[model samples]
Target: MDKLQYDNLYKFLVSLGIVLIVLPVAALVFLFNMEPILISQADYDLLSDFSLQMIATRNKLTSYFISIFPWVAGILTCIGIVVLLIGIFKWVGLQKNLDKKLDAEAAIQTLNLLKMSSAEVAAKIEEEVKETVSIEAPTPPVSSAVNDHSSAMNKYIEIEDLCFNYFTKRYANKYSFERNIRMGKYCYDFIGVSKLNNIDLIVEIKYLKIAAGNSRMIYDVFERVYNSGVNYETIAHRNFKCVVVIVTPKEELPRLENIVETYCKAHRENASRIEIKCMAEESL
Candidate 1:
């Protein structure tokens, strides 16, 4: 039977046992009080010596009850005690089983809560990065190209190599160039992971005079780097850093730095997670 049924049955048995034990004692008391004398005092004078001592001191009704009721009382008391012990033992076992079940359920719930917290942390980081890029650094249009396509491509490659070498030296064995970091529907450039502090790194090299819209490319690079870093952090539970190296002439470095400084000032909280550097083309 179920726990409830067993509990109810045990309670009833306990009550019945108590009644059985008590009823016989009460009946014996009543019988002794009502039937006090077993024989008449006048009859004692005529009786022989052996016959005078044959009868009980109490009444015959009490004597008859004493002969049969002692066995009945003993049997009832034994049954009552056994039933009470069984009920108590079973109830305690059921209670312990219930406690273990509750503990298991609570453990499962705690694990689910931790999973949800992990997802929220990832989502919050992604949202903050998106906001910083979209508001502080708006995408620019494809203006007239300042340099021819062939020369610009060669210059871009040289600068990218220089930046790679710089980071390789700085981060030692932890640096990677053109590593596949998957963002939404795209893979980004130069993703590195630092084991020392659990830092996710994204390095981008920007050459402004390219035939393509260099200003527009800057926003795209920023967004992709941040998203990729956030994705990595979510999975690995690491800190993320985005580094953008602008490759322009020495004369133009001041203007680009001013632009990056303006962006940083606009979004100070998000800016702390990013680094923007102006590198001269001559250095490449």
Candidate 2:
């Protein structure tokens, strides 16, 4: 497991070993010296009789134990040392892996930030030029078919109230009253659209009762979008796309799957143009 757990286990084993070795040897020493606190009157009488009977014996019970004590102590000490070494080794290995992961994540984040900043700068320059130079610029015509399609897509608004409700309920006890409050809704789904030279996208939140089925549909949508010549980077930067996310009880998966599948197929063309994904309740 973790370094803390390993270190704690090692410490516990070392403590146990010390107690086992020291307590037994200390007891033997007290018994040999006939320490009053070490033995009761009954025990002393029994030992006296045993000593008399064993007068011809070359070894005493305490003496035998004392001779073996060093070996026992040495074995326990070695075991404790080995356990500690193993814990240290595991801790070092985990730390190295964690560091590598963190460094890679940091590099990725920096690259993404730079890309976004560059796009923003380009957009700003385009806006400035349009405002400064307007010499009878040809009026851009809007297509009626495109307008109708955009309106139809906009009509299918995804409700995100359920997701907000789930999170608020999930974290109620952990947050304060004010902190626990949720605004209108939390959205995490996006809709995709394709134009001649540019793509339009809309982001909305939708709730799905069947999370696994929804996840599969999301994968299908991503595949369709990718195949439709839409790159992930364009989708990420486009503002016309909307995400539809749905939240429902996890147990409703079986009943909700059919309904979700039906909806996905009915809007297959529109859905194909978009990418979808699910975040589990636990993740939220």
Candidate 3:
């Protein structure tokens, strides 16, 4: 059931239980504590045989009912208490599950919004660059590889800027850009701490322009991410993890996935602590 339905059901069960117990509990308390009044010997002797016989029959029936009343009340009270407890525990568990689900949904929504914002920023930058190039005189043609490399480098810088902006806003006081932490021989692009969750984050941003045959960029960055993750774990001696965000064209995702799978397979232990996410350049 949905949370609201479950909530209503919980309230119903609690109300029903309380209703069930009220009368039985009151009866038990009053009936069990009550004393039977006895007639005096003189009054008993004055009774006719016929009257006495009728009185004896009536008393026998009353005694039998009185003996059974307390047991009935006790059983009903127990059942009511059990139902009440069940309703309470069910309500508690339902609330906990809803909280977790809400948290997960919120996290996903935030990531999606970040992606959309980054995409808009990248598009604006590309438009400005195109306009500037159109105004300038035609320059000499550079080699395909060099031109590709330069374009890829510029894209990486843009991605880095977007990520930096995102982390500053997201992590606020805990995030740093190009933090100089001596993790062996390498330094990561960003570092942050989650004080609430007790986790340290190492973030790496890369733009793999492999769709135009610049595959080496992804491999080199992946290796660096792996090495940094290992070193951070070794030196920091605490809860630490690595996040690698790669921006590439959608056409190259299969090849990227294969490379990532192979690399992670070879370094299984560290791979568990390293999270690699690929974003389509078109989607920013």
Question: RMSD in angstroms, all models?
Answer: 18.9, 15.6, 10.8
Off by over 4 Å in 2: 1-70, 89-93, 118-221, 224-260, 263-284
Relative to the unseen true structure, what is the C-alpha lDDT of residue 19 in candidate 2, on a scale of 0 to 100? 54
Cα TM-score per model: 0.42, 0.27, 0.44
Q: Write the per-residue lDDT of candidate 2 for residues 1-284, one digit (tens) a residue.
A: 12223245544444554454455556657756873235567876777666746642534655676788778767766765665566556656666666655544443343344332334434433432332122212232455545633332332222233444543465443321111111112212222223221233333344343344345544453444343233333434333343444434556544445554665687797665554444443444
Provide the global lDDT of candidate 3 against the true structure.
Answer: 0.62
Error of 2 at 162 (Å): 16
The TM-score of candidate 2 is 0.27
The alpha-carbon lDDT assigned to residue 146 of candidate 1 equals 27
Model 1 CA lDDT for position 233: 59
- Model 3: CA > 4 A from native: 1-7, 30-65, 101-207, 211-255, 274-284
Model 3 error, position 61 (Å) = 8.2
Top-down TM-score ranking: 3, 1, 2
Clash count of each predicted structure: 0, 23, 0
What is the model-wide C-alpha lDDT for candidate 1? 0.58
Residue pairs with clashing backbones, model 1: none
